[model samples]
Target: MGLLKNLDPLLTADVLHILRSMGHGDKLLICDCNFPAAEVSTKTTTKKHVIITTSLPPVIDAICSVLPLDYFVEDRVQYMIPDAGLELPPSSVDVKNLFTAAIKKHSDTSLSGVERTSFYKESRKCFAVIQTMERRPYANLILQKGVVGPDGNDLKP
Candidate 1:
């Protein structure tokens, strides 16, 4: 607790270290309980699968509290979409809303959709994957880290 004031308590020391160590442009994957987190994490930059015993919304809120969303990319946030091109699942929509609220102050960036297979491929390249206890289907997303200016705000071009 040493002087850290507004961050969510759910963000453990390990989680905070991971978030802090990530460089701008690195990706962080947040996935639901059903995801193959252990397997996919093996390929990530950190090769770590962090399991946080909480739901997605709070986790997103906690992560976004300190992690800036990329401004250099059109879609710094990405979610899994059904391969068949069906309507976005309810959980996915909920995740989108959560991300929207979390990043509203830092960026005007929008969330994009990646098909299931492609999403898996992208997840492998992330800095790390945080698995939440969210049971809802398609409650998975990737957040690209962005730069912070000297004054502690997002750095835009």
Candidate 2:
């Protein structure tokens, strides 16, 4: 059996490679089942992007375990807001809390909710989007990559 350093087996080699290749300030979109991940990812014509379809919470846990949150930015995590008149679904709330708990384990930060259109526009520029099978409305999240110090237990501010 091969042993990994920080990530687990659920985070595949391709995803790990993508995570390692990303630089500070780069963004990664962790989308829910309702998201149009394929369509949005294909819109990015400048750089090649990868789309991994998996469960949201596990992927979120794995990514947060290794990837540092951008402490320099005001909001390192961005979530999608439900359309006007549409109530925030219970699933969405659950997903938000799940992500918050995971991120809090690594950094002292909260999730920021953005307009749906704006979130979609931002998704176009992300390094990759991991589409989750989570059947939650508005559960999408965007994480900004942060730099880690030489000692590894660091988040550059």
Location of the lowest summed lDDT over 10 successive residues in candidate 2 = 44-53
Clashing pairs in 2: none
The candidate that achieves the highest TM-score relative to the unseen native structure: 1
Flag clash pairs in model 1.
none
Candidate 1 scores a C-alpha RMSD against the true structure in Å of 2.0
Best by lDDT: 1
Per-residue lDDT of 81-144 in model 2, one digit per residue for the tens? 8656667878678877877787777777778888888889888988777777777678788899
| Candidate 1 structure quality by residue, lDDT tens digits, 57-129 | 7888788778887888887899888887577777667776775676664467677888898999999999999
After superposition, the stretches of candidate 1 with alpha carbons farther than 4 Å from their true spots are 1-4
Q: What is the TM-score of each candidate against the true structure?
A: 0.90, 0.87
Determine the C-alpha RMSD for candidate 2 after optimal superposition of all C-alphas: 2.2
Predicted structure 2, TM vs. truth: 0.87
State residue 121's C-alpha deviation in candidate 1, in Å: 0.6
**Any idea what lDDT model 1 has?**
0.86
